[model samples]
Target chain A: SQQGEEDPQALSIQEGENATMNCSYKTSINNLQWYRQNSGRGLVHLILIRSNEREKHSGRLRVTLDTSKKSSSLLITASRAADTASYFCATPRGKLIFGQGTTLQVKP
Target chain B: EPEVTQTPSHQVTQMGQEVILRCVPISNHLYFYWYRQILGQKVEFLVSFYNNEISEKSEIFDDQFSVERPDGSNFTLKIRSTKLEDSAMYFCASSEDSPNGYTFGSGTRLTVV
Candidate 1:
């Protein structure tokens, strides 16, 4: 199915704390994409990590891919209240298949 | 930065009414797609268009669902009839290549009253 399933469907953290979300796909994939959605808003592109890459970083966002376990994780460091949003991981297999996202609450 | 633009951020329609959602994808992108997310649910694929015709569609995109690139620039999704369950946020996306390089629009919130 190539469907990505995310764990810890919801998370709560302090403003300065870091938040991590994990995703596991049923089958192998070429790449994994991360997206964020503010409450009742659009999804924004966060990052894309290829299967060959073990780890990648963009600003405060860091993403790691472990092909052996078919899992991926996104770490947001020093989160702010603005970071409160839902995060999703997706895989492309003819079409983009998304996971049930993780709703992150970064309390100020 | 270029973006996929969708019109009417929110629309309210009655049951059995027809509605056409519009989108303008990034100029250079060749592949276009439509996806929907019901409240608190996973995003679901509706259809994909390329070279001016539908390349793929999901079961949810039944006969009632239609997509068109009437002009070189405008893309539209038309639903023959709206149902209560059809209420969701419809997002338009464009990609330079299939399954990658996608940019999404703000999305249209469709409410079936």
Candidate 2:
């Protein structure tokens, strides 16, 4: 399976705290993207980091990619209760292959 | 903001029956894709469509699965014969460029009995 593996299957943090999730993939990739899913809802694109780039930031979200390590990390600064969701990392080869995802919980 | 739209948010069907999941991708986007997540499993790619033809497909998309853009706006996935294992959340996504970020629809939850 070319699917990426996300570390720390579940995370809990208080409001105003930062939440971080890591993803590791097995093969070379063109780009890696992070998405958030709230409960039964569909995925929302958060950010995308290319293999050639090391880091990118969008709003309160920060993403880092390490091609040498075949891994990427997503950080949410000062997370809010609304930020609670399942976060997935996807690597697009021919089609996007998604990780099992990290479920995040932010307590208000 | 433009978004991918899918119809019939949830459907309950019997095994061996045929089911068609429909989606309307963002206008001007040339790439379309279908993916499914079975309960708690990771999302798995089913197929990708471009230029009105399938560009790539996963092993899971066997003879039973087919994708078609019958018109200019509608992209559909037809399952010839649904199985109990076919119960999953099907998501439709589209991208203007390959390997770029894609906008995904809310998804259709199919419950096969």
Q: Could you give candidate 2's per-residue lDDT for residues B1-113 as a string of tens digits?
A: 99999988999999999999999999999999999999998999999998888999989999999998989999999999999999999999999987796999999999999
Give the CA lDDT, 0 to 100, for residue B52 in model 1: 83
Scanning candidate 1 chain B in windows of ten residues, the lowest lDDT window is B94-103
Best by DockQ: 2
Q: Candidates' DockQ values? A: 0.82, 0.88
Counting only residues 3 or more apart in sequence or on different chains, how many pairs clash (N, Cα, C under 3 Å) in candidate 1? 0
**Candidate 2 runs further than 4 Å off:** none
Candidate 2 - CAPRI tier?
Answer: high
* DockQ of candidate 2 compared with the true complex: 0.88
Query: Candidate 2 at residue B102, lDDT?
Result: 95
TM-score of each: 0.98, 0.97
Q: Candidate 1 overall Cα lDDT vs. reference? A: 0.93
Worst 10 residues of 1 chain A by lDDT: A1-10
Top-scoring candidate (lDDT): 2
- For model 1, state the Cα shift of residue B106 in Å: 0.5
